[model samples]
Target: MNILNIDLYSILIAYIGIALILAKIMGSLFEKYRLPAVLGEILTGVFLGSSFISIFSPSLSWFYKDPEFHYPLEHIGHIGILLLLFISGLETDVRTLKKTGKVATISTVMGVITPFILGYIAGILMGYSNQTSMVLGALLTATSIGVTARTMMDLGVLSSDVGTASLSASVMDDFLGIIAIILAIGASSIISLAIVGVNMLLLIVLELMVGMLVIKYIMRAMEKIKTTKAILGMSFGLMLLFAAFSQMTVQAAIEGAFFAGIIIGTTAESKIINDDVKAIAYGFFIPMFFVYIGSLINLQVFTNMKAIILAVVIVIIAIVGKVIGRAVGAKMGGFNWKQSLQMGIGSIPRMEVALVSIMIAIKGGAVKGELADIFLAATMIFVTVTTLITPPLLKWSFKDEIQQNGG
Candidate 1:
């Protein structure tokens, strides 16, 4: 292979190499500063993507501009998102969720409904169509359980009443967010809405029957295989199979991937493949997904007064809605004012699921053209800002607890 003889395959290999290296370094730096590594990975893309490279190093910008580079990278990013959702499903603690009690249930409901309504109203007031507003609402309905749980663990409260409720509620929040996106996709017409409803019902039935029954045995059978990594291979294959089936029926591949995870997660073999799956996902695919999200962001949007206004308004609505809604629910669920506030702050951050919802909405044509560009950029800002602010605010909310524990 001549070093100078470059082709599309070569370009892709080179791009992946550079992206992985940069993603790892930036991710490490972010983790060192106690920030989300995903945010840093996104920033890496921004630095090398059109936002910065086009301005700082015009020659290199061609890599992003060339379709040869963009499309393949995009497909890889899709795989990353699928794996991410699968991991989310795998980590879902069904037993804990059932035991989350009335408090978690009430908080989850209000947390989802409040942000969704506020986001929709904000979108409508800003002159967006009903479908776009619905998608916007859907975007606001998820909380980043990963970020919240990590913060809680660090604060020594992951086992506290408030922490348990928040984590369980956040898990439900993801499920609702996915549902919201599906509803948004079908909201364009009455016939579409009816079809969507039917599809949802079908999905539920299938998930109950196939996911619970068939997949269990399949995983158990795979466990008998003596081949190296065979269990892992079988698990990955099941994820893809379910993803395809889900997409074919419900028009959402991630939905299938998620359900597949929940099924396999219940199997005894789940423990065996969990670490390896995460290694493949985080080490390569998931970082690329977030970076691809970053690359899609048009930094030029920030310069537009209209875009700036929209982003700011949405961010405010996101923070306020979650706090108010979850707080009230927490209070109603038997917490004091201070504890309710803590719950609210804990539920504020929205990351993977939020970003995935908006991206899917855009790709599904629920949002398009200038609106898509604007919303995408606004969402990136929203994710970054929420992820940044939640940790410090969550700590502040837990001050009394920390002080009492002698920390």
Candidate 2:
């Protein structure tokens, strides 16, 4: 076989095999240490990707050098993200979400505004151009719903008040962040913010209309499927279709997968579907997604002191800003200080949503040159730190409750 026509199938097979094995080993090890399994998966990626790959296995440099292998693995990892969110959507208690709706809204709004303002100020104070500052602000506004959701599930609090509020707030957090990203990018481009705002509103309306129509059709079709295998197949197909559609029309495919799960969750068979989704997702897809997130981290920019300082400042603002904002919002919503703080801590992780926006801003020249690399590295660091912190904070926050339950 010619070098130009390398065996894509073998590469993919090897990648999956390696990813799954590492994810399982690391995931189990983390669980053994009383840490979140996803953390281990992500660490595995960090150990293998841009950060530490060359140190351990220079021969494997071809993995990242070849776009053919890299891009497909990324796509597969993205599928994992979609499946995780879809499963989350399936398990989401809509009634609980509605009960916490007002608080979730308030928390999400504060979560977006405070971090954004703080990030913008920090950037400007650091002498970055206003355009770059605004993009930095936009990046700070993201809340990684999947990461937080996983933590809540791991802690067995996904259905609790703080957990539900966190999940609900994340939806709003992602929504507002998406809008901010559009505005920030628009400020740098020929397009006016007003035009971008209008386009965003239109996109939301269109997504809602199309999502509802497709979901309804899927629900009815699912009713006709009798066998377990057929139902599972139908469920997976619908999830993939909706996820792809969401990517095409919206900011993220997970958004569509989530809503698709919500639609299926309304059916009598939803519990069965949820279990099935969980089995496949946790076993493979979701772990791959987190590991892929780690793989994207490049610490090469850390050598720049200015970038490092800016990154540290931004991380501080990101962490403190979210805690203060969401804690206040949670307090206003009648949560006790413990629950409120839990909510704040839960809001801290920023992953795919922020990353996608940052990548776009970099490509669009909103954040230029070495600054972009530095910012990217910083975001990855804090996201990892936040992910590491949440589970332990959550356990601490629920100590009394857990003790009372005799755990």
Candidate 3:
């Protein structure tokens, strides 16, 4: 194929158009299926990703041979994911989280530890080196709420007692996921650091301390902002500034925004900020990001048995890890066994944040780029299955009826 055939700009335009249209279609379809809107978008992503369609689509195969087409799309997609993480932070009720954060933190610790170790072992046993093992562990440490949130929202369990705890666990998961990525990256860089092992302990303490201080000061100033517009607008502008501040590690920026959101989510101001940012972030960047991801699909990667198997195994590990961790903790927390099991199932889907981290890890050469594709596929599967199943389970548990619809 001639280099001229690979028009970067044209691909970007095409990828965006196709992705957005697909996103809406899939979104509505999933909604009809009683699943989260995210499942549709993600399933679309996997459909776009599979080599069977992408590689042999004859005239459509132009997208695969052209990195110019896929690479930029990936970058744009990542930015979408990053902003989504920031949005996650914005949506969190910081005051309630603070009240729950400690309890959640204790649970998150239990949640991550067993999984981290199991993931590390799984990676090693699966022929992944220490480096990939660490990366594997980092990826497993995440709990993607975007996928789950859509499901929970559609099912009307998003604000219920069971739903909220699952949400809180994921919120804590996001915060911890970012920290885990940073520590994993840190650990991966200095090979000698391995002698002492990954020291996420320090990151855990420091993030909470700094996060608390940042919140105390920022919220005080935020309280004085009379116009709701100014508060939400500047908050995002600032978020992007910090996100780009460390090009190599945007986790800090993402986490910072999340913490910032949690603070406002705790206040009366939450409704104002929530109503506002929805249009701003979702309207532009998020769509761009998801579409770009669609564009990144190379359909040929699926042929690699090693990559395929590793992806499947890691995904299973991710699910088992979270289920065991959350269920056990929930039982201890006095939740019924069924409720605990439901929470475990409810937490399976991955979101934009984890995807972005995979993008960065790929770019930095910290991990294999193909791993990004694997994670995307695995996450999509989890989202689709869990989203549909969760609603029915919740319905049965709650007597299959809503006396007063929250909606």
Task: Give the Cα-based TM-score of candidate 2 against the true structure.
Answer: 0.74
Runs in model 2 deviating more than 4 A are 1-12, 56-60, 101-105, 124-135, 142-198, 225-228, 243-246, 269-271, 334-372, 387-407
Instruction: In angstroms, give how far residue 107 of model 2 lies from its true place.
Output: 3.1
Which consecutive 10 residues in model 2 have the weakest lDDT in total? 246-255
| Residue 219 lDDT, candidate 2, scale 0-100 | 62
Cα RMSD, model 3: 5.7
**lDDT values of the candidates?**
0.85, 0.74, 0.61
Q: Write the per-residue lDDT of candidate 2 for residues 1-407, one digit (tens) a residue.
A: 57765576786677678878998899889878765566688778787675677767777666687788788767777677677667767776667566648788888888888998888888789888777888888888877766667767866778898988887787667657766875777664325556666765675567556655665676667778777667777888877777677556534455567667767776666666677778888887777777777776666767778767877787788889998889998888788888889899888877666765665576556777777778777776666676677677777877777776677
TM-score of each: 0.93, 0.74, 0.73
Better of 1 and 2 by TM-score: 1
Residue 286: error of model 3 in Å? 1.7
Candidate 3 Cα errors over 4 Å, as ranges? 1-11, 45-72, 101-106, 144-164, 189-233, 246-253, 259-273, 335-339, 349-353, 369-407
What is candidate 3's CA lDDT for residue 204? 32
For candidate 3, list the clashing residue pairs, or say none. Answer: 51-299, 89-258, 94-262
| Candidate 1: pairs in clash | none
Q: Which structure is stronger by lDDT: 2 or 3?
A: 2
lDDT of 2 at 334: 82
